[model samples]
Target: MSLGILVAVGGVEFEPSLLRVAEAADIYVVRRCVDVADLLATAASGQAQVAVVSAQLRGLDAEVVAQLADSAVAVVGVTADTLSADEALLRRLGISSVEASDDVSAMAEAIREAVREPVRSQPEFGENGPGEAATSAEEGTPPGRIIAVWGPTGAPGRSVVSLSLSAELARLGAPTLLIDADVYGGSIAPMLGILDESSGLLAAARAANLGALDAAGLAVHARQIAANLQVLTGLPRADRWTEVKAVLFRTLLAVARRAHAFTVIDCGFNLELDEEISYDTAAPRRNGATLEALGSADVVVVVGAADPVGLTRLIRGVNEVMAAVPGMVPHVLVNRARSGLGWSAQEVTQMVVRATGLATVRLLPDDPAACDRALVHGQTLSECAPDAKLTRSFSALAADIAGVPALHARRRSRLGRT
Candidate 1:
């Protein structure tokens, strides 16, 4: 089997000797990408199994690397400039194989090596020795469980569920931090009536990248909503996802988990690893936070609307997430499961189980008034509408997640208009 290489080196750097060396190694130069767009297009055409790209090429960021990987195209970065920063940037962007030598033979060898090390769906956690702890930090505390609340597009109750769940966990006396990780339009600030525009996520990201983030530094970024509930708002604009890198974001998550008893990430809708156009536009995908959050999560709560159309999207969304990371199957949460849409909770539950092959589903009733009150008051369900069935359900979820008996019995109440 001949390995095809898409060469994207500068025209000046593409010396005749480079071609001769690659061809000798049985690496056929099938295409020469002029830019990032052409590189992606060529890779998508299946003409290339490996990309021998110039590291100085424009639009070569982590997202670009990921899109190339999505096409199963291995990337071998060739740069004569062996600066440490450039190499670190490439690795962070998911490029593992890089040739720093100026020789054409080195480029050929790098392409061959990358072909042998293809990307795969990674496990949630990395390989560690038996009996070894996940973190050996000075803080000898078991980190809190990080639960990422995600859903499909079209405003499925992601924020509401995230807020209520975190609030309930805090109310149960577990130290909780509610993170608004929505890379698109984050409504956590307005919903909670916290008028501050300083996104804690960005602060944490900046600190994490600088290696200055710790428990106390993180505290400065959070808003103490209640005794045990803290809020970290998300991006001020939808286009600001570029501020967060996957590796740096992962570091922030570790600090948050260690600092709290429960850290809940209110994630965005998109899960796509979007193909990039250029290095200028090679910002992190809008759902970089969501994917990283999911990958880092101990549990994932996927909320979907319960109407017929909603259920269909939910099924597909769940399947897509499962396909992305087969190791972590999310807990399905069917929001608006009440009868207003002419579907019973039991029927929706059965449909979810059958269609998604998921073993369980949690139902949250359609209570517009209860949800409104919480939003209006900028308070959690437990605080705003304590007796509402929605509040009761959130509390129950919190209990199960915290692994403690609930302050109130788990209410398997009917989906009735209150």
Candidate 2:
């Protein structure tokens, strides 16, 4: 019995010679696909165990390769030059077996090699790879941390907290990447006074789709807002969420961890799981980006308003998120802690603890004047009001998270203010 193969060389003139050599070696050509869609459909039919694809094939990307891998179709990429940039790209696209298009004689061995390799398991996002040890040990760079700011409906200030936290962390000498992963409505670009029509997240997603997104590629997309703070702006329109795939988003986050000491994501309010009945299993979900961000986060900061209705929603939201992601213990942050709300910090903490069983709840004092000033100027609170209590609170939180001394956190805040 010969090994079944699907060939999609995309107009490469050497296909006939490669097929002749492969057939001579007992490799049968099951189907010759016209495009990536045809290749995928043919691979899914279970007739082919190996796919010989051109490195320059139109629409050939990591997602297509992933789908092929999912279908148990091992791929052997044929590039014009084995040592050229295309070969490197194919390798980055997770093609382990590659053959030079001009060298048709070695095609059979490449097919056998691809089939010999085991299907790769999905890597846990943010987990360090094998090569990370030597690099980290040499550079003395610790693994970066991811903090996802999420909240219940009714505007619990997720974006505010995310921006403030990232800015504060950067002010404390930690490099930070602020990502707006809100699928419903992402306002980070406008909030930061960035009027560019292009979105960093969307750009990064495109690079990821093409298997070209690395730390350097991500930095190209991210706009440097401060000396130590860079921001990956979110979607321009809510409906454009489908353009950002969840897997690619996870890959982007993993790349972000390599480039920054801290990544703060402003997540969407929804925690609903992808429904099986309502949508196709392979289709993109509106909340998929947010869900991936939360899952990849090292810390989930659940923010909520400090009012009666807000508190009720916060409690239920916390429970809902916990149910959606088991073993997730969030750090609750009650925003806008005003005396006018008729509740002390202790009372709010007690209420949150009694309902959500959280050990501690951080309070962010209401400073509408400072917030409004920052908003109007498109600057962070530290820049506008470094001495404000709210700014000090954020500095303290950053200090705690980054292991900076809190005793002089306020002084440092003033010193680090841009």
Candidate 3:
């Protein structure tokens, strides 16, 4: 079988040796060029499977390293000094392997290994390309899902719900990743009491800029919050919003999906449109980030307050959510539900149905103390207040989401099985 190859050399001393190695390996040397730019372009175009570069090549700079790292081609640096800074730099740039000696046979073996080995690539959430997505799914060390929790405006309790849901999912034995995709103002790190100075959104943007963000690269940005739960917090500052792009968010979500079984995202509120509104605007918008998260969600939870104003907001938010998200039937969550409002759970459900024509699947009681304690302590409800009504309710919601039987049925099933 003929093998495709490209050799980039700074001097003519190693040209004949490279050709001999190629011939010995029964591989067709496609490009015997000295220009690093041409070599990179050829590699990027997918014409070459393996790139062999000389350490002496002046044009093989950081830009080339960054470009090669992003491309499908496998890069191997052949250097005279294994301990040289150049060799270390190449490896740091994500080169697959580096060789010190000028031995043609050894170089050829390295090339073969690099070519035969799988190349790691980034994940594409939407309709970018099949190859990109497939590569990520197959090559990912720990493939996972990207579950984006989304809702409309008017204080819908999306953040609290998402945080609780992620914690519960992690409790259920699945390795889960929680991401804060609210570009306008992300509260995840603070809510979780994580003093994270780095935001995944910014990291993703930088990755997109260098074209180096793949499943593996994104895994580096994820911070482990629990044994099974990881978090990718939001931007540190709102002014740096320009650094984030919709494509980058999509790519990061895709990567997150591959890294864990469940990747939960706390997305922004506004789903009707994409915008970057000024601070003075009443709507508070950051369209690009929110739209991307909502578009790629596997499951979306529409959260709303239990009161009348909150219900009105939920009603309007649902309409906008349905229009913005194609082919999505959201699960509604009613927050701050209490009998003191003179409305029972059933009655509140009825009222919401009457107003929005959507059923409430989950209801959380108004327990500001419990929530405040958990947020302040950086602990989940299960850890902070396991016996609280809101905690129990949230546990039930998680059980339902994970398809666990209800309390009564669980007891009966256990007795029957026994």
Tell how far residue 332 is off in model 1, in angstroms.
Answer: 0.9
Better of 2 and 3 by lDDT: 2
**lDDT (C-alpha) at residue 321 in model 2:** 75
Q: Quick one: ranking by lDDT, best first?
A: 2, 1, 3
Per-residue alpha-carbon lDDT of candidate 3 for residues 1-418, written as tens digits (9 for 90 to 100)? 5568888877746566556776665667788766887887787777777777866676564346545645767777777666776565454334547785557777778878877787633222322211232234444244564566776666567788887777777777666778887766888888878788888757755764444555656657777777676777888887777666554565566556665677778887755442334332222235666777777776777888888888778878877777778787777888999887888888878776786666555678999999889888877776677678887776676567667754631221110000
Q: In candidate 1, which residue pairs clash?
A: 59-278, 59-279
Worst 10 residues of 1 by lDDT: 123-132
Top-TM-score candidate index: 2
* Candidate 1 per-residue lDDT over residues 12-42, each given as its tens digit: 4544555665556487888877898999888
Work out candidate 2's RMSD over C-alphas.
3.9
Check candidate 3 and list the clashing pairs.
143-258, 144-257, 144-258, 144-260, 275-287
The Cα local distance difference test for each model comes to: 0.75, 0.80, 0.68
Which is the winner by TM-score between candidate 2 and candidate 3? 2
Q: Among all windows of ten consecutive residues in candidate 3, which has the lowest summed lDDT?
A: 409-418
Q: Candidate 3 clash total?
A: 5
- Please list the residue runs of candidate 3 whose C-alpha ends up more than 4 Å from where it truly belongs after superposition: 1-143, 272-285, 406-418
Error of 2 at 93 (Å): 2.5
